[model samples]
Target: MLTSAILAETGHAAPTVPGLASVIPFVILLLCIAILPLIHKTSHWWEHNKNKLIVALSLGLVTIAYYQMRGYGIAHGDHATDPGIRTVLTVLDHAILGEFIPFISLLFSLYVISGGIRVKGDIPAHPITNTVFLAIGGLLASFIGTTGASMLLIRPVLRTNSERKHVVHTVIFFIFIVSNIGGCLLPIGDPPLFLGYLKGVPFLWTFKLWKEWAFCLVVLLVIYYAWDTIAYKKESKQDVTLDETRVTPIGIDGKINFLWLAGVVFVTGTMDPTKPFLGTGWTPFPFLRELLQTAFVGLSLVSTGKGVRAANHFSYTAILEVACLFIGIFICMQAPIEILNLKGASLGVDTPYKFFWATGALSSFLDNAPTYVVFFETANALTHEPGPGILQLLSGHFIREDLLIAISLGAVFMGANTYIGNGPNFMVKSIAEHAKIKMPSFFGYMGYSVCILIPVFCAVMFLFL
Candidate 1:
């Protein structure tokens, strides 16, 4: 299910769905990502972004070529276009150009601008201090976005716990709280919610999800507090002392970037071409938002004080890796996306709980934004003219309220289930790894999510979802 703009650009309502076999490139790329880093032979080879790019783009382009051969990329043709640019690559690249560039642009600007503003100085590494810090991050996330908040605060969190021997759990929980679950409160907080807003769900209608958002946030924060207390007790006496005494008065550097950060939020929240948001009217150019965001990136780069990023030891490698990997993931995953678009309603997901888990399960792997859209459309399809169990929304969509809430919570919260579940998850992990932290492998991380997040989500399911 491409967006209306994409469908309009393609001049086609429905392209032929790729066969299930077309999912092979995506699955192969995912397996390579999961297993390659653990293998002795490939571990070193996968370290360089160049090598990663080779595998990523090779598989991505192969899928593109396959789609072309299948004539899915051509304008109503039945064969692949020869060499040069895949010239009439309409719907496929149209979707890519529409989403991918903006996706990368938003991340790039947030990352670069946040990198310039250093949150220097370490406070006590006590569990309470870290808990409060994470809670602050959770609050910031909804306003500044999970990606923005993660980029801004991750270094501070790492620095606060620099002396602790048991800091891995803190980072993992950071991914849980700050990077994923915390962003459920508002549209600007996560991509899926923003997509919902663009689809004509009222901007503040999501504010009603405060219950589910608070439930998950409080649960995760409580778990993190308990977990950190236990780990703190187990730390060596010397390490604990260093944590307590090595603290410096916390302060902000490169404060001007706050203005730039606000600019990003404004652009993201109001630049929707589908809506006349803030009286901007309909934008004819799809990439205008991205262009403005890139402008912010350029401004931050030139205006930031020399060596401000030195405090955080910032690098572009994390953002570069995300760009490389998600381009492939986004393109190759289209087969499965189209599959879900076609078959989602037949999956026996009729109730609220079913919608929650179904949307969430796919969001855990396929990236949440499109998954939410598919399920949203599926739920919409169920409401042909208002039947039993159907409820009109405040935003005026007739999608059952319970199902919309479930889908919203599922897409926003369950994105923490894996490294690739959300963009910021990988960025957080990458930054942690660069700081010399031994972050868990892909499956290793899911082990944490399964044992911890699953139970919390289950409680949420019964009590609220």
Candidate 2:
């Protein structure tokens, strides 16, 4: 049984004892994402069957709803004539209204606004120059989102490295630093941290993580520089004429989009549950922050010139794919979230190390936003914090600060463990693939993470956690 705090935070009443059957849908979805690509080599089966995958996952939603209604009816006498219909509506409302709309809207706005900006240049792709570009991307990701940063910078990086034979490593490292670890220091940086802000964590509290962020950034950058230097040498040996083209100065187009980008950041940063824009008397539908962001997206579309978009080769394919896949992901993820909410307290996670690994392991596969909330609630249960407030305020004395730090680093850093671990990862991959970079398949990419990122994370846990 979940506590009242858990129920209020999760927005779901306690169901019957969640059995193994309850988690099957989530398991099946993960397996399909991981395995289907490996099985169908040389065929577009995975791409073609995306609709089928969504429908299949929806069956899991229906199953969970049926069981939830049955459990509710048994526990508290049958009050409604049709519990099944009511349960379905409740699940749909929570999944779609409570989660999906805000998530997709933010991503859509960032994608559209960033896609409009075009950085035009014929920069030479030297090892040192490439390193600087990635460093800039890491810094940019903390202001704009990982999705926005990746979309904005990937094209220029790709164009710079257009003549290089060994280009895959550069993009992989870009995903590591820019798409994942770089967003650790601010709520506006990553989806998981933004969720923390919405749930009462202060906006600047994440800045305390600068030490961890700097440590990972320095280590990864040094490693990337060495690796890229070696690859560049190999390519140079093969083709001696690669250095004939001189570097050109970079210029910007659609500079107005930067203003809209700042608007997106300001809107997200100002969202506060304590002071709803529409007053507490009215039901908060889209919330003021999201509405403001959607407006910014509309403004960017009309304000940016067509020439800028043409230079950028901007298209809607990446955002559309994210929208389609994430809708089903949010729906199918409810069961796992419910199970975690019910059972997390009993999981023996009393220490910082335990919380770090547990939160990170699940975040490597599940969406990190809800995963952060689950562990946040679990930590809150330990402290018995009276109500929702900033963790800095509420848990300062009662909760272990090291444990909170562990959860924060784990959720943010370990998202690099897989492509699906973070939102920008797949979008970056899709864009790189469209540009003719032969990105590794799902498992192949995990092989890189395990070999490279896992050891670095272990060192972080030892030194920091």
Candidate 3:
């Protein structure tokens, strides 16, 4: 019998119909793992290690089952009038079809390339050089976005501190300050600000956070410089000679992978569901657009096999692990998202600053994209008008542009509070660890955030925000 008909015959209402189709991937994963050892299929194994594949497949299935059971009740709820099907489908559509699978391959490729491009040569040994780099890095981040600046500069920073024994702290501080905080000055710099931009917040609305960004940068640079100076001085006290033999040019020694990098950014920026791909005016043909995106990404992967592979023998391990773990996370998180969205306004959050902190606090834990949406919804519910704020009277709204700016700044800035808070943050950390610089544990990471970032953020809240 047809699945829907069978369920109906069992006295299930339309609201009780679960999305059984969504479990197909999980089932396929399990079946592949279960029968892999029994059958001597060479193509089935490919280059993948079977034992690891089995473990990963098992984990993935377990995750699917957990989420499925959590969502099962809502799908088969008591009330026939409940929005169960809509809720379940939204979870499957957004978390699985929307996020996990599509971006995983691209993200994996980016991680490999990020690992390959190590900077060489001696940086200027001046005391203020690190500070200068931090300031320039922040400005670069504002324009090209944080990921661009981080990728471009991370190697050079690593190379500069290559000789120092106590330099890991310097790099960690760099990620905390330049890589994340520096994205605050422009809407294009981070995802949250970019979301704000699409939602009618001006590109320059980010300028309102300039004072905060500047304050945080200045403080962080001073701390970094102090740390760098002490490390340099300690090294100078010892008879450390500059390794002129190790000095090489700063550029990657292969065919530039600019096209591939550009494709990665294009996939990330353009695939967002909230944004309309087609505009009112002239547009690319829909079929051609998809074809072009697919071809560009595929060709970029092919180009990686060119002279670039010799320059850096790239492997897809770290990013593959990230892809595997995040698929489960993204899928499982749908349940929490639905529950949160349904009950968001009832949480009793009000006021712009309240939202500013609340959104930021959660953004520090959850992925910043959905966290932004949750608070955006809360702000939407609080006010019945076009925006997410209280209503006003004669000609002006109670919630001014500054208020929106504050909330926006908080969401974007505080995403740096932990490694998981932003996508690039954890990727960078993983890459750093792969390069043999030991990263802190989760709570240990939070210690750095609390010790340094919180004070700077508080100063912003007191002064500008």
lDDT of 3 by residue, 20-73 (tens): 444444444433423443456742453244443445546555545655454343
lDDT of 3: 0.58
| 135-170 per-residue lDDT for model 1 (tens digits) | 999988988889999999999999898898899999
* Prediction 3 TM-score vs. true: 0.72
Q: Which residue pairs in candidate 1 collide?
A: none
Model 1 spans with C-alpha error above 4 angstroms: 1-17, 71-88, 280-284, 385-397
Where model 3 places Cα greater than 4 Å from the true spot, the runs are 1-88, 101-120, 124-127, 198-204, 236-239, 243-314, 386-403
lDDT ranking of the models: 1, 2, 3
Best by TM-score: 1
* lDDT (CA) per prediction: 0.83, 0.76, 0.58
Candidate 2 segments exceeding 4 Å error = 1-15, 48-70, 73-83, 236-247, 277-285, 385-399
lDDT of 2 by residue, 327-406 (tens): 66777777677678777889898788899889999898887877888898788768745345325442243344677788
Error of 1 at 3 (Å): 13
Position 411, candidate 3: lDDT? 73
Model 2: worst 10 consecutive residues (lDDT sum): 1-10
